[model samples]
Target: MPYPIVAAVVATMVLLGIYLSTAAPDLTFWDATELMAAAHTMGIPHPPGTPLWVLVGKLASMLFSSAAPPRAITLLSVWSAALTGGAAAYMAARWLGARGAVVAAVSAGTMLTVWNNATETEVYALSLLVSVLLLVTGEFAGRPDTDDHERRRARALMAFVCGLAVPLHLTVLVALPAAVAFAWRGPRPVWREVVAWVALAALGLSAIAVLPLFSAQNPTLDSGNPESWRALVSVLRREQYAVAGLWPRQAPLWLQLGNVFQWSDWQVAYGLHPFPTAHPVRTALTVLWAWLAVLGLRRLWRHDPRVGRAMLLLVLSASLGVALWLNMRAGPTFGVGLLPKGTPHEARERDYFFVLAFWGWGLLAGAGLSAIASALGRRLPAPVAMLPLALVVVPLLANRAVADRSREPVASLPRTYARLLLDAVPRRGVLFAGGDNDSFPLWYLQQVEDYRPDVTVITVPLLGAQWYRERLAAQQLLEVAAVARWPGQGAVLRSLVIHAEGARRAVRVSTLLERSDRLQLDPGGGWALQGLVYAPDRQLGAGQTGLDLPALRRQRSMVPMGALAPLPPGADPAAQTAQELLQCTQVLGPADSLLVSGCGGV
Candidate 1:
């Protein structure tokens, strides 16, 4: 077989093997659960709906009928990432030969964020694949050997994929300029061809309509309930996250830039933080890595200036360009300096936003590595010469501890927490919960796993949305009374507890909600500490103020939070939970009492 074919196959097998070995075997936290829930049920998700992914994920679920819905749906990300790595390697080999292909495959495949996103059900992996495919198609189409007919067909496909990316994931747009600039370089298409391309593009754009059509059926997890044309427009525009302008940055531009560097530092060295958070050794390694990337760009410029310029546009537009556009809150500027705990205001690390940037670097790094290996080969014995090439294994070995999802119990831990909390609640109880880690997992278990459907789980912060309020009202879970928005959700939550009590339905609260001081769930408010959840206190207004259940408390250990990364301002939750809960609490079967499925009824 030709080198490109060999490269594609080898890269696919290597990356796919690595990904599956480390892949999340079941459900996950954050948007993973929500996205899986939406796709599995053919319902709506958060703003923009991700209709393209939902459709493709649904198809994967159907094809893999033997597997559980969560795992089957998650395969879309896993396979797409492997395919992306293969495609990337193929492109590198086509230009830079076999040595470059090996380096490219390793660099792209083992990127911390890329690897993490691939191991679970998420949009980024598939989105990256689509965008890369578009880039690859455009590059091949513009080749000198390519005929006019082939070029025209390729352009049409590129146009369609570009339009399709809108409903898939908007991050793909970061790649727009480079992909289009090259593909459209030929003689301008006449009005007739232009009209045809536009029509094809419009067809791809039409996929966004899937949201409204699906929402009209009233699916179980409709986020925006975008059944009408107006509602669809709101979701497509992402009204939740959109801002009028880029002024008044979320974090100081300087600090945010530092954050980008810090996260990039972690990409190669995960979980093994050197002393004092920002070790000199790490800074040295990061500088070396940046130099290699620059060297790779130099190689590209020398080898193929035309392609180099396009890929350069890709790197800048993807990395620095995206960072500027995000104006996002500060992340943990770990290596930057000693700043206040709250000084870095980002909720979660924003490294994933620059996925393409890192991916682009992988190609450059491959070129750089190949050049080094060649130089070493000319100066040393064959065995000694290949030593430098072993750096390809560095990422897998170094990043394994943190990026290996198979080892990370974050997936089952949330389900375990949900199991204990739901089991503790009475039948038909209304359970109020907290953030993505707390609430989304419960929804995944209840809706996707078909566990604890008898209990209703409401995310407190979402109560601020009128759509959510109306949805709950329609289900008779809550009434559309005057509401207090999130951060001050206390009043509305208190009213909910009282209303549920009046109806004689048991009301419970998740401890996760305690993260917000403005929300009240206390023994004084008739809530008794029951295991990981707070249950309605029957003895409210009586002499006893606090109540606890020993039987329920025993199950608390089952909730493992070992997957959470350490953030500043306090001791790490993972460490704290391990010491306080995992050490003393009664243990159970599997992984030395680190609950896999859950406490029970999973």
Candidate 2:
């Protein structure tokens, strides 16, 4: 096949793969939470991290229902990746010739990292797409013979695109050095034109920052008070500090530097341990891309001495620096010490590999493809020349198949749990959970069933004293006495106990499981109490007493079973009920205790 025809086919396959993969499932973490929150309110809040994406998601949801919004937004992400890939292909073809374009197109289209993000709601893919476009435009305008006016126009457009990407994700700012270099290589423009272009770019980018400012002015955009703006600013500053290696007591600089490449290994072994099969293709591609990157750098240094050498060096330094910064901010080495243990943030430090690997793979593959084509010209028949194309095409098809299987459409726990909780709870009561996990449940239930004003689902972590002081100011949840045990001895009548058996054993489960009771069976085949419970007269420790069978029978308003006999199957007389009472609550003896409950002002 002709090189252009081959590139077109490959690009089309990539786009189809991205669309199908994204359509298959909702794999992105925190996506539901951010979208739901945005749907209910106007301005962006803390946590969900990407304000721009959230705003866009909210708009999408408004146009369509929440159920359909995610898929629609995912489609947009797919298109963005395809467009970026095409731009990379064009740049390669223009710079290195037809063979280079074919290599670049295949490499970018088949890249696992880009494909992974294309099927999710994360902002990285969008940022990367914009970055590639800027680079391509810059490269095109940098030709020595390009007229000054044309160069000025091209530089201005590049600046504008970079500026638009800034608010979408602050990390895109890392590409500024490359952008500046691109512009400097071109013919000098009049000072006035440079100033004018800079201002236009700033204005376009500043459009994103304006949302927060507008929110500050209109407090009604969110539920919080005016002071919430200050909190938002503080959080943004902290994030910037963390990302820039300015966070205090961070890991040593050397370890942070090494973390970028090693991060993928850590993520697979530790982050997603039990689910090792989740992203096999992505893992393999990451390693392959890294190897090719090193090889590509060597080749650039040897043959393509000027522009290629500079590009290789710049990519390496920038990638290393960015990787170090992300590692410190994420603090993955501390294991589960951070808040929201096992969240995507803790695992995503490895995401930098996507961009780094794609560039490396493209450049190296371009060089290799060019060489092979040259060698085949004299020895191989024309028909056999298509074999090299097949080599690139097959892996891409396999990659797409793997990507499709790895994603699950209804895979989100938050959406499932939220729906379940909403159904279980009473219409006029509150349901409390441990952390930000509660946010999604609350937002979804309220939006889906209109349960907000009547039924509230409170998250304990967000209600803590420190959280209130920082985000809520003096208006904080009212804390009652810190009762030590459970069914709490207090007079609070109604409570829904949700015991997440799976979560209790994990590291850093305390914030969520701290005040809950733990029940277990003894080795001797009797019930065993594992935690304490509060009572009116005393703090009942575990295994302190047997269950009050007669009292429980009376509570049930029925006859009691005699002695310690087990309840007979299908003999459901109230007489057999008392024996099963102990099993219901998992009480070992009369003195066993239960969990407690209370509420606070906010």
Candidate 3:
């Protein structure tokens, strides 16, 4: 086998082994559930729908049999990550020989961000794989070893791949300037070459059509519903989530630096348990790694200035560029922002966005270590000199235990929540679920596992949008106009109440709105809740109050009062059940105590 092919196979085996040993057995929180569900049902996911991923996931699903849909989707991540590790190893081997390959393998394989994504059903693994491919293809295309014909073909191929990668995950745009800069250094393409590249790129970008194609079938969780050209353009452009108002206000320069500092720490030590606890030791290691990265860049520049400059650009663009963009707050939208008071929020962790930076640093570190080994080889016996390379085991050992999720039952909580919500609502009921955690799993359970086909779940945040309203209208027997009038939670809640009362159907709100103050929940008013609201005619007693646990206890499908916890602090409003549960003095057992203690800001 060829050197690059061998290196790729070795890296793939190593990464796949680790990932399989640690893969999430079932659904994960937030995007994992949604992505898996979307893939299983051939539905479009959140803004800028990943049609390429959906197609790949569907293919993976058919080839791999699993207990559930998420398992199959997670396998896709494993394969992508393994391929990424393989590509990273191949790049190092191609650039710096056998020793460099070893160093790079350790650097990329042990990265926390890569390992984290490898365990779930997210798109980052594929993003990482494509990134490595883009860098490798671009690097190899301009190399002296390649003939003119091959170089031209490689550049065009890189262009096409770049185009495909961008629409798949917009973050892949970080590679654009670097790819272009490297391309300029090579032979200028003639008109035909340019057109060929452009045409191929156009072909690659046509993957967006997958959304409209699948959407026409109306799958269970058709996010964005890109059935028409206008809707297709809107989703592909990410217009819904692209609002400037959704971004948080920019932070002070120092805080932004701190943000970078924290992100740097996470690159290697995120999954390790005791690694973070030993702050002084951990900080020293991180600083040392940064220093090594700098040294490696310097060494690379001395060896090959073009490659060194390319590596530098990759690091800067991926880290600093991404930091500047992410840190800029877009104010507020609907009085809620992604991360209200800046990053480090539990809901949205931004560290994953810089996987490219982590990859760059890993490559640099490998080069630096390889340089050191070369120096040692000149002074000492080869065997004696190779001993220092054993240090690569440090990160591997430290991150292994925490990253190993083979036994972890991550799906339990979401699965339980989905079952509880489904059971709480009556047959063919309309369930007004609160947020991502509250709603996405329901989609997964319903669409993938075939948990409950009758219950209709309307996500609260989507209620404010016309697309979502239209989607709900098409799926359910509800009037979009009346629902759209109230906007926010009020609109959805009122419609559910009216539907329950008039249509003789069941309608249950996951929890009452936090701005319960603005919208009246009185019996005669637009809103009302009694106990769990299991039935249409189950009117609340005078002053019975919102989300009564005692009443919920008596329901046919009982609320697990002992398992409830207070909603964590977020920019979004708190649900009534979660809000009231925080103040509940009743402790059924140790479970409730543990659950209560888990709630922050209680």
Candidate 4:
């Protein structure tokens, strides 16, 4: 079979698998829903904002008329990314040919960041697609044989696409250096052609201004308010740390440099610092693939300085952009708090320009592999020369094929939880859920039922105590006990509490069983109750579990029990909840052996 055909097949299968696995009723765990919600509403005022990409999602949702708007947007993104991958492969093949292109395409498809973003409603895929187009067109325009008309056309196209790209992601700025290099390389161009190219480039670059025009929900100057501006400035000032360290205070220059060289290695082998357990297998493969790509670029540099220079510029620009974006958005702080505390910020931050790094590196790797095989091609029989190449190709393709199948079920967890909560709680009742990785449950329920106006979904501090308190007062119920509440009318005293200190708090689960008699034991020996909590906890079962049903019913009809289970020592039952509430006169104090009334009614 032709190498192009094989590359197409591999790319298609990989994309299809990702789309199928991820397309569902809810959002991916990584706050994709928050972005989708903003996208659906065409609001750009939020952080990590992507005005152009959100518009694309909104348009697709309207066009398809699908009930699952986010899924539709995600599917569209996947398709676009797949096409981008194909275009990239074609370009690589055109530049390096056959074997090199196949390696590039396969490497891209297997890339953890690329595959992950393809299934999300983020701008990463769109940015990647536009970047690939820009690179390819720039390459074509720089060709020595290209005519004035063709070069002008390519320049205009590049400008228009770049213009469209800027609002989607600010990182598109990285392409400018590459563009300048390409424009300067070709034969002495006609002055008229140069003027046209410059004019088009300016026009394309202007599209970034439109970002502020999109609804106030976008991350532009209009929506962020004075504080947002302050945050942006704060982030900008820390640009050095953003690219180098976990935080400004603790960052060391040497360490940051080490991180850059060994980032792929560290991310894959040890994983990222906060989410150390994140996609280990993918991380490892990415590191290996990236290293190989660097090798390829080194070999190509000796022969094609232009290609080498272009690759180097693109990689450095994109890497710096991504690192800075991640730093600003994820935070100079280490661990999970690296990202902003809100869903909106998380959604936006997740679209860092790292995929560009992956692409540049992948191309370099393909070039490297091709150069190696070509060297052997001169001395050995054709089949013998191909043997080493085959070994590398088969494993990579297989890895991509396998990795494509490993996507997390974005829709399943939130949808299932929503169903369970909807069925478990009264139509008008408020549910207090502990920790949610993605904001999917809230968004999915809002889409299916108009209950968002009535239903309150809170995620501890990320949801903010003030907001949670306000919602609790309005709803007249506290669904989750993990949240801390100030003294208030609508607030009920919790009997049992669970809190996880540090980053684990994000994953901690808190449940409030309205009635103790309703509790049942599951086959796995985990307690089954009216409400289930999912929070981050160092010691799994150490938090306050058993609630006094009889006392709870007698004293407070709507009893709210919370557990603050920190890392090692755990929460002292007498100090955290029981005594704390007693001081507020909300608890039935000095009561021993409270009698159990029948589990009468919910």
Candidate 5:
């Protein structure tokens, strides 16, 4: 077999082994659950609708149907990551040779951000794959010795792939100009062929049409419901998330820029993080890694300047350009803007956005290490001289403690919460969920696993939308005007609970709303304890004040909660349950202690 093909296959197998060994056994929090459920049902996800991933994930889900629904869907990310490692290895091998391939593989494969993306159903893993492939393809297409016809074919292929990224995620736009320029090579542009390639690229972008196509069928979790031309345009343009043209800045520009380095410093020595625990060691390793990357990039410029220059542009576009574009709010600051008292923030860290940038830097570091090996050739044997490249594997080892999800307790929390809550809600009830974690898992369990299909889950955040309101009004048999009349989200929710009561159905709310000041759940005001969730019907209490230990135990037995048992007091909100339960809500037993600690805020 050809060397590049062999290199890709060998690297893919090795990395896939590591990735699968640590892959989440079930669906996870954030977008992973929603995307998995959407793929399984051929439904739509949030804005711009990620149709390409939906189609691809659908196939993976079917092929791996024997696994749990979330785990099956998560395989897509695992494969994308493995393929990414393969591409990185091949790219490094092109200039750094076999030893360079090892350095690049170790650096890219186990970088904390990249590994995190690999374990779940998320877009960035696949986005990183395509971006790396573009670098490889553009490098080949940029070769001066390549035949004209072949080069044009390669460039045309590059254009179509680039177009596919439109639906994948617009983040790829930063990598575009560099990739296109490199593919142009020495040939003077052929206008007619260029136009034809552009047309073909548009055709690839049309993959997004799956949003309207599948949406018209009205799947269970149609996020935007972009079935009509107008709605489709709105979804495609991302008007729902459009924040007045990416400015009026979400965070101070300096803090946002500072996050670029903040994210970078964590890549190689991520295990020593929550930093300051081993600050000196972390800083030294990070500096050494950066120094090697700069050296490698410099050597590449002196040797293969054409490709080297394009790569620097690609890395900058992927990292710094992305940081500016994202303009995210304060996310896990390392003393920079530590007190940005009143700024919007991301729900979670956004380091995954820079996977392409970090992965590219790893390849450069591999080349730089090879350059060092050459410099010491006279002093050391050829095989022995290259031993220093093995040191690059330090990142893979350092990050493993944090990045490995195989036995991580929090990784399985989403699945556990979804299953427990779904099983606990009374049949044909209305479950009002508070946030992404509180709501998405229910949707996945209902639509994909066919669990508690009769229950109506109303996500609180989406209630403000007219379409969402109308859908709820229709499903629950409420008057449209009455549904719209609610003065605020709190009012809208109270109405839903009352409506469920009138219709002889049970009412429940995720812990967020229950703990919130939004509703009147003061004992006499129609609310009862329902294990992990809260039932809003005073009737079920039967004079009870604490949890139903038996019910909680049954729910616990049904799902695998991983290693952690009974979250301790004052745990993070994502891991907490029943805020009011914290008022000395005494523990029942180890088995039912998910939130039984009765003194925390999840």
Candidate 6:
């Protein structure tokens, strides 16, 4: 069999085997649930909306829609990861040789981050695949052996892929510098070809139109209302997350550099056994990958300066350049970034953004290994030299325990909580869930499993956006009176709660947001339920003032969060719940035992 075919097979087996073994059995936390719900409903997701992924996931769901929607989407990610691994392997073989291809396959197949994402519903795998294809096709276009007509076509196609990538994930743009370098190193460009490329890119980007179309369809699962051109621009531009895309004001330069360094180290050492950054073995392995990448670039330059220059630029551009840019780009990370006071910021993990950089390094690592094989040929027997190559599998062994997440019950914990909350409410009651974790599971249960069709699930934070408000109004979930006070995009969502109360609408609040000041979930003014509150005044209320701890405890579905397992040390549980709520409170959960005064009264 051909080496590329062999590489593909090897990569697929590794990726599929591990991913299947550890895939999420159902919905996951964060965007996983949202994505699954969106795809299942053929609707738009959070911006910049991942329309292409939604389409692909929708197709995947067709095969198992009756039995399991979560599995379908999770499997889609697994398949995408496998494809990415295959493509990575093929690229390595084409660039280096058979041995290098094996190296690349193992590296990508065993990557912890890649494996972690493979078993869930997420966009990274697809993003990785598209990015790798761009690299491969872009390189093929630059090759001297290619014909002129083919080269032009390849360039145009590459541009189209670039445009497609734009709507998928912003991180893919990190490859732009490398793409430019590849073109510069390849054949001279024609103005017509460049123009064609630009036009094709625009044509490809028309996928963004999927948002408005899907939004107009009135799907059971909808996020942003992109039907209007203005809304479309906001969704596509990710204006909702603009603060995150902008650079941080308070972070020091050195801390940002440190964050990048640690992030880079984690990427390289991801799946290595004993792979903690502080561990000596993991540190050495990270250093080895780094050194190999450096050596590989040198080898590439020696072999073909043009190709070498492109690959080098790609590595730097994708890795260091992206790392620097991401570190500089700040938002509430949940707690990943370090503060000047030596404290961690919000806890959201940001390592996923650097996968492309690690991808480039993976290619370079293969080249480096190939170069090593060449050098060892003079001193050692070929078979004996090849024996050392087998050591690359060590990281796979190391990462197995960490990456095996297939046994995790999809949305089991959250689903349990969701069912509890839903059951506690009367039929046709409205439920307000604050953050991704608190809300998306409810969406999945509704859109995928068809749970509680009569009940309404409103994502509170999303209510701030005018597009979202308009969407709610169009769906009859909201009336004109609900949003009359808010006239702008991304406005306060307090009126949503107030409107529901004024209309005598029965509502249930997520424990994560029950005590929020924004929506005024108090006990008075027709908001009589102690388990849930509706503050007509929207004033600062005292702790447990109107909270019904006994009623909350008596509910069969209300499980005490404190009774749950301990959170990781130094990890703030509040930050996770903080996504929707505007302020922290002494009472943390629906039940009294779950209360934490550590939040300090707001």
Error at 30, model 5, angstroms: 1.4
Q: Write the candidate numbers in order of decreasing lDDT.
A: 5, 1, 3, 6, 4, 2
Error of model 4, residue 52, in angstroms: 1.2
Error at 511, model 5, angstroms: 0.8
Please give, for residues 405-506, the per-residue lDDT of candidate 2 as tens digits.
Answer: 223222343343344334333344444444444455456446534554454444443442233322322212222222222223121111212111122211
Query: Model 4: number of clashes?
Result: 42
Off by over 4 Å in 3: 181-184, 245-249, 271-278, 326-346, 409-411, 475-477, 482-489, 511-602
lDDT by residue for model 3 (291-402), tens: 7788778887887677788889998998888767666432222112424554333334456788888878877876777778778999999998877676666666666665
Q: What is the lDDT of residue 146 in candidate 5?
A: 80
The candidate, 3 or 5, that scores higher on lDDT is 5
Which ranking of candidates, highest TM-score first? Answer: 5, 1, 3, 6, 2, 4
- The TM-score of predicted model 1 comes to 0.87
Global lDDT of each model? 0.70, 0.46, 0.66, 0.49, 0.72, 0.64
Better of 2 and 4 by TM-score: 2
Candidate 4 lDDT by residue in tens digits, 1-602: 76655665565565566555643444554446556665565544234345567677778778766556656767766777787767766666655666667666655554545655676666777777787778878877776777877877877787677666555665565776776566545456678766876777677656444444553333311222213444344322433123434555233334333334433432222222223233556465556666677777787577566767887888887776545434432322223433335522222223234667766766676666677777788999877876655534433343333223223221243444344444433343334443433234464456434434343344433233333343443433344442344533222323112111121221212242223211211111222122232222223243323333343333343322321112111111212222222212122322322211211111
Worst 10 residues of 2 by lDDT: 502-511
Tell me the tens digit of each residue's lDDT in model 6 across 396-424: 67666556554322225445555555665
> lDDT score, residue 205, model 5?
95
Could you tell me which residue pairs clash in candidate 5?
296-368, 573-602, 576-602, 582-598
